[model samples]
Target: MDIELYHDSKYGNGARVAEEFKRLAETKGSNVNIHHVREAGSKNLPRADLYVFGSPTHFGKATRGIMRFVKKLELPPGTKYAVFGTFSGAAPDKKTGKMPSEEELEKRRRTIPMIDEALRSKEMAKVAEMRFFVKPENLKGPLEDGWQKIVEEFVVAILGK
Candidate 1:
């Protein structure tokens, strides 16, 4: 299967994750291509059997830039897709804490639901399956604990033999 990975990383970890995903996918036997969200603008992507979208979670949602980029991630009907994100927070609190992280106030005010909904129908109408991960922004992650299995499983299920 041909796979395309699109990502927007502020600290460039998003790209690193995209590269790791491509490497892993390649070992699994697929021709993979990764485009930095910025570079994605100049080139038209080839038709891919699978499409994975990722971004450094900024303010509880994908970056506005990434979200805009996702509008471009739109694929033909039935294209398979998945998603992942990175964020820094203790978790939501009952009272709005001072500074309210972007994920807290939701900078774009439409991060989670927008990406979730987009992956549901916009990016790929027939998502074989989907996945989400949260990592501390300052700590840097795409951590490889039990979480690795979650992503691997998502890929395996989507590419059922």
Candidate 2:
């Protein structure tokens, strides 16, 4: 299958994950084209069997670049689509020493769904979705270790391998 994947990465975490996806998909016998969202422009993308988009979460949403790209995306009806996101999970309360509540978690998890919604708005069919949380190491992330395992799982799930 032909896969067209686009990503918006801040500090390179999202781009690294997208590259990993491309590598795994190619190993599974798929032709993949990966691009940064900014460079992709708002034109009609090349024909592909599957379309995948990913981005790092900034304030519980896909980065501005991704949102802008998705906003202008034009895709054929019923095109297979998937979404992924890298989030730096909820922060702890310094004073109370407590974790974020369920509601807060829900809010923080909205990035992928938001992207999925945008794709669906373009009449794309949703095939899969995933989220990978990165550890905040002064924003120089190594992707919280073992992130490749989840990437592999997502690739299998999305491609039916």
Candidate 3:
């Protein structure tokens, strides 16, 4: 299997995930090519069995660069694709120290959903989706614990190994 992984990682969290995904997929006998979105333009994306896109959540949505890249993709209809995102989990209120409810966080976390919409609009088939949490206190993060395991599981799920 051949996989192309692209990421727009402002603070490196998404980049880290993409790197790990590539490493694991390669070990499983898949050919993986990884690129930053800026380096891999939409007009000339390499052909692959699957394309994986990753981005860090910005204001609850994918960064403008990533969104533009997804919008410009011209892959064949029904192309296999997957998405992943790095998000800062809800932080507690400074004064009250009260954390937002899961429901509220859901409303605020639309990074994956935004990418999914763009891919769906292009008629791409989604194989899987995932979100890795950044620590709430720091947006530019060391991702939450066990993120590597999560990425490994994601690679297995997508590669079917």
Candidate 4:
């Protein structure tokens, strides 16, 4: 399988996750190419068995660069794709000192959905979607522990090996 992975990483956390995904997919004998959105510029995206897009969450949505890239993608309809996002999950409530529930966080973070919407508009088929959390205290993260394992799972799911 051939895969093209594009990412918009302001602080490099998303890039790190994309690299891990690429490494895992390559181990399964799939060819994976990684590119930054700026480098790719949404033109003539190489054909691949699957396309994976990653973005860092900004104000609960995908960064402007990624949104623009996705909107400009010209891939044929019914193309296969997956998406992932890196976010600093909600911090503890100031009053209660308790972290927000996952349900609440899901409602607040729409990064993956934003990307998925653009892809769906172009009639692409989604294989999977995931979110990797950044440490709440450090938005430019050391990702939440075990993020590599999540990437491994994603690689297996998309590559089917």
- Candidate with top TM-score is 3
Instruction: Assess candidate 3 and give its TM-score to the true structure.
Output: 0.96
**Each candidate's lDDT (Cα)?**
0.62, 0.85, 0.89, 0.89
How do the predictions measure up, each by TM-score? 0.68, 0.93, 0.96, 0.94
Which residue pairs in candidate 1 collide? Answer: 59-102, 59-103, 60-103, 61-111
- List, residue by residue over 44-150, the lDDT tens digit for candidate 1: 66788777777766554668777787665546666677666654534444476445565544553444456667656654554543433445333465443455555
lDDT of 2 by residue, 1-161 (tens): 89999999878988888889999999999988999987898687898998889988777778889989988987777989889988875567668979889898778667888887787788889998888878753445768889999999989989899
- The stretch of ten residues in a row with the least summed lDDT in candidate 1 is 129-138
| Winner on TM-score (2 vs 3) | 3
- Model 1 error, position 50 (Å): 1.5
Q: Quote the positional error of residue 41 for candidate 1 in Å.
A: 2.2
**Model 2's lDDT to the true fold?**
0.85
Taking the candidates one at a time, how many backbone clashes does each contain?
A: 4, 0, 0, 0
The number of residue pairs in model 3 that clash at the backbone is 0
Error of 3 at 44 (Å): 2.4
> Model 2: residues >4 Å from true position, as ranges?
136-140
